[model samples]
Target: MSKESRKFHVPDALANLYDFANTLDLRHFTHHGIQHQQADELHNLAALGEWMRQHGLIERAAAPSQKTFEAALRLRAAVRDYLKCEPAERHRKPAVIGPLNAAMEAFALRVATIGKDGFALRPVTSDAQAGLSAIVAELYDAASAGTLGRLKMCAADECQRVFFDRSKPGTRRWCQSTLCGNREKTRTYRERHRHDPASEV
Candidate 1:
């Protein structure tokens, strides 16, 4: 799997999850040339749902199964839409952030109850629950205060990946510097050299 593909895996900690979620643009399900099959997509949704439950953000809905995975996708899409829209419009639409956050929180709670050893739902430990709760709290705080920081869209022409710009300047332009950034730099270098051969020396 590509580096981008690996990024979607459950993070090691709550802070990492928040950073990962913001950095990822769920609108583009495909990563690193891998088109998601239905099962693959479901897995992604399930993972997010699990993360949500762990964070104490949401309660388990009836029948937590693949169907729940599907529901999570819908919720994910709604959240994406909310983030994509203008702040004023998002506020005007009560169904946006409020519902989305609730869903996320509920999902986190359920996942927390299920434990954190793996994706499967099982009993959670106190430490796990506390960690998840902390993550959820921090995420909500950031969202409420509009201090989530610079959530960025990818600069690659064909890639719509989003990421958190955590650079010193908070002006990062690519989802992954080794990938999209390098590609852009190479392209610019080639173009410049082609246009002005003297500069190559």
Candidate 2:
């Protein structure tokens, strides 16, 4: 795969890692239908660190230790959870996402001063704070513009994960078809066949 595609495409290692960290669902790591909640946080964090390493977001640190992975997971979970809230909610309760955006902007600015990573990294600086600030503003703009309506909850009864559905028909209901859709379809097919024997042949 092309390097950029490999780096950012959803379901790739990095994207999977990002998704895992951003959304905490136990099913991603389960084996034999048993959930492993204990490692959920740690796995999420480790995935982010791996994503950063692959994308050159942060300097490559050593392979994350178990403790480091858990800490990163906790830290990222806090940031992601905070970001998921409405801005008004954030204002009423200052929390990690606010500070993280601040810190990331600062880091972006610091990198910009060095003329190193280009505009992608420029969002971290003071001048770019306006742009960074736009992200928060745009959240409201998007809400006002009806853009937020594109957000959807996965159709799987047991999985309520949220996603932005960019499908042309806008009819997508599951986070992934191979995973949830197939399972539901298979169960339905069996149920119909069991009740209507003529269709089974």
The lDDT leader among the candidates is: 1
| List of clashing residue pairs for candidate 2 | 105-124, 108-124, 109-124, 109-125
Please tell me which predicted candidate would have the highest TM-score against the true structure: 1
Minimal lDDT window, size 10, model 1: 120-129
Q: Tens digits of per-residue lDDT for model 1 on 14-98? A: 2443333443433433458886333222256456555555444346551244545554555545545554444335667776767
After TM-score superposition, the amount by which residue 136's alpha carbon in candidate 1 deviates from its true location, in angstroms, is 8.8
Off by over 4 Å in 2: 1-22, 26-139
Question: What are the TM-scores, per candidate, against the unseen true structure?
Answer: 0.42, 0.38
Candidate 1 accuracy as TM-score: 0.42
Error at 135, model 2, angstroms: 9.3
lDDT of 1: 0.50
Q: Per-residue CA lDDT of candidate 2, range 26-70, in tens?
A: 344343687545333234545645654554434454444454444
lDDT of each: 0.50, 0.46
